[model samples]
Target: MNIDSIKNYPTGSSVKHKRKITNALEYRQESAELCDKKSVNRGYSGSFTGIGINRAAANDFKNLGNTFTDKIFRSKKFQNIVEIFENKTVVASTLVALIVAGVARPLTNIAMAGDKDKEDSMYAAAHAISSAVIGFVISSIVMAPFDKAFRKIKDDPKKYLQGLEELLDVKEIGKRKLEKSKPYKKISKVAQMIPDTLVLGVPKAMLTIALIPPILKYVFHLEKGKKKGAAPQAAQSQNLDVNNNAVKNNPAFSMIKGGVK
Candidate 1:
């Protein structure tokens, strides 16, 4: 019974009943605490298990990345490409220029399309072609002498690199030895590129710009009979139309126009 029922019983019986009730409550509290401890232990175990699983997955991914990288490094085709780029520096540089000017620049211009003053895609193509041609021609001509000189040095490092043997810390440097030296190879590549980078770059760009108009006229037949004065007025009128349309469609302009009305 409850505490109220114990009050109607004898004093000694009531005290005994109260003791029994207290013992039951203490046992239930202890059982609840034990259950809580068991749940906490289970939570810790599950957390550790989750951590172990994540660590295993991470390790698997790491091993897979390493394996893929190792395969690429060991591949014969990859090695051959690397060897070609290292040995055929002129070819490498020319290919880079072609990609930048002919491929990348033209693609960028086409993607940008009508964002600029020159709306004609053919003009962009012509410019890209001119740039690529000028870069290839000028680089080949200018780097040829430097390449020949470096080749001579590579052929006989003993004669050319005589005084710098001690600085390089190698005795009797051979062609193979010099080729294998990373620092020397880097220096040789940079030295070969110097004339093209410093001397020919700006002059070649200027020459390309000077040649683009004639190329567009003769080769592409664009703007064939247009007068210079008319062309400027037409271009300016087109730009004004574009700007007016942009303003008319703008959200802020719409808000201002609505407010004014």
Candidate 2:
């Protein structure tokens, strides 16, 4: 009989109703299993998964940053500055790469060369190598103060801000609870971008600039990858495989491990 006809007997005695109940039970079990998976907690109020402040977002920021640097380097006014960086950071291996790939790569091949050949492995290899040098040079020169500033903030953001306050002729740090001021917000974003500029921005930009044929190589190419600055650090669980195995194998380990911690 249909479920509608089951009113003649108690609900559990109805086969259709029992089947529906079994389905619900299975659905609930599946939902419970999903809850056991990882979810990023949303700032104490809620939680979400695979949404907002993710890796792709950070990579976008870095790529944008590298594009900016590319413009700066390509500017006619910045030739001297770029040269300074090229001179300062280019070590022996980089010097060789710069000379060989930058100079020889262009003059050696005519018919063999052309950026339209996207599948050419030799071109990509030469580009990645040569671009790495220029990338290191530009990032190193420009990011010196940036590196120091980020390091200062990373170690102690409060102290760094307080130092700025003292320099600005505000009351000493301990005299009052130092707070964010208008100028702080203005400088915060540019200041925070330094790390990503070094790590993701430079490397991606290197691959970018390197890929161009000898003429426009310095003016183009940027593939920004990450922004460590904006991204909050994720707490990592330590791998203790031996300890886990011991606890599983010996129930007595539960007491010993628990008590020690």
Candidate 3:
């Protein structure tokens, strides 16, 4: 703190607070020094520690690993082994494995947080590897049957599309049966629509609008047929005159009040 700020404080309280701050600063410095000493002496065979076997073993193991890795990578047998995992199925499985490993982090955050007291380095590493293996196995199992079909579809898309049309229950559009022996009669709205919408991705608004015309035509034609059949019968039921005479010459009508007056 600035001298002026310290001077602003009451003399007694300021000296007390100043001593407390000084002690805190000294404590922090001592802690930092201890940490530095430990880190610096970590690799050293200091008076308090014992043998240097671990350091020598680590160096030798590193050199041996490097030698083997270089040899394996350069060998033709290794290249062939690498090529074995280069196929579509294994590549797809590898991709799945990587994705599953990445997803495992957030997924384990809650569950592992409660179960384990603290993280262990080796356990974390093994869990990541296991996650990838689990994903690879699952993806392989799921993609097995589809692999040959996928290859076939990729080879000949037209055949695959024909098969898809059959699966989706689509029929050839506008192929009218001109030579049909029987007359054509309209079918229900559901039967009329299924083929068209099966191709159109099932848009409800468009399907409803498309159905209006066929339904309207059917209704109008049905009403016209009923009218045509009823017209002659209606005419035949009209009242008939018993005698060929005018209204004034009819005897029953002349007997009434204003019929013949």
Positional deviation of 230 in candidate 3, in angstroms? 90
The most accurate candidate by lDDT is 1
lDDT of 1 by residue, 112-143 (tens): 66644344444545555655665667667766
Worst 10 residues of 1 by lDDT: 229-238
- Estimate the TM-score of every prediction: 0.49, 0.23, 0.23
Off by over 4 Å in 1: 1-84, 87-91, 111-118, 223-261
Best by TM-score: 1
Task: Give candidate 3's whole-model lDDT.
Answer: 0.39
lDDT of 2 by residue, 1-261 (tens): 464454233454567454533465554554444444445332222122223335355465565536878778678778875554433332333444456655554345434545543223233334444454554465456556665555566456566565677553445543223333445444554455535444556454544444434422334332122212210111011112134334533656545543432
Per-model tally of clashing residue pairs: 0, 1, 0
Which stretches of model 2 miss by more than 4 angstroms?
1-119, 152-160, 163-190, 194-212, 215-261
Error of 1 at 240 (Å): 27
* C-alpha lDDT of residue 255 in model 1: 54
Whichever of 1 and 2 has more lDDT, that candidate is: 1
C-alpha lDDT values of all predictions: 0.57, 0.43, 0.39
* Residue pairs whose backbone atoms clash in candidate 1: none
Candidate 1 vs 3: which has more TM-score: 1
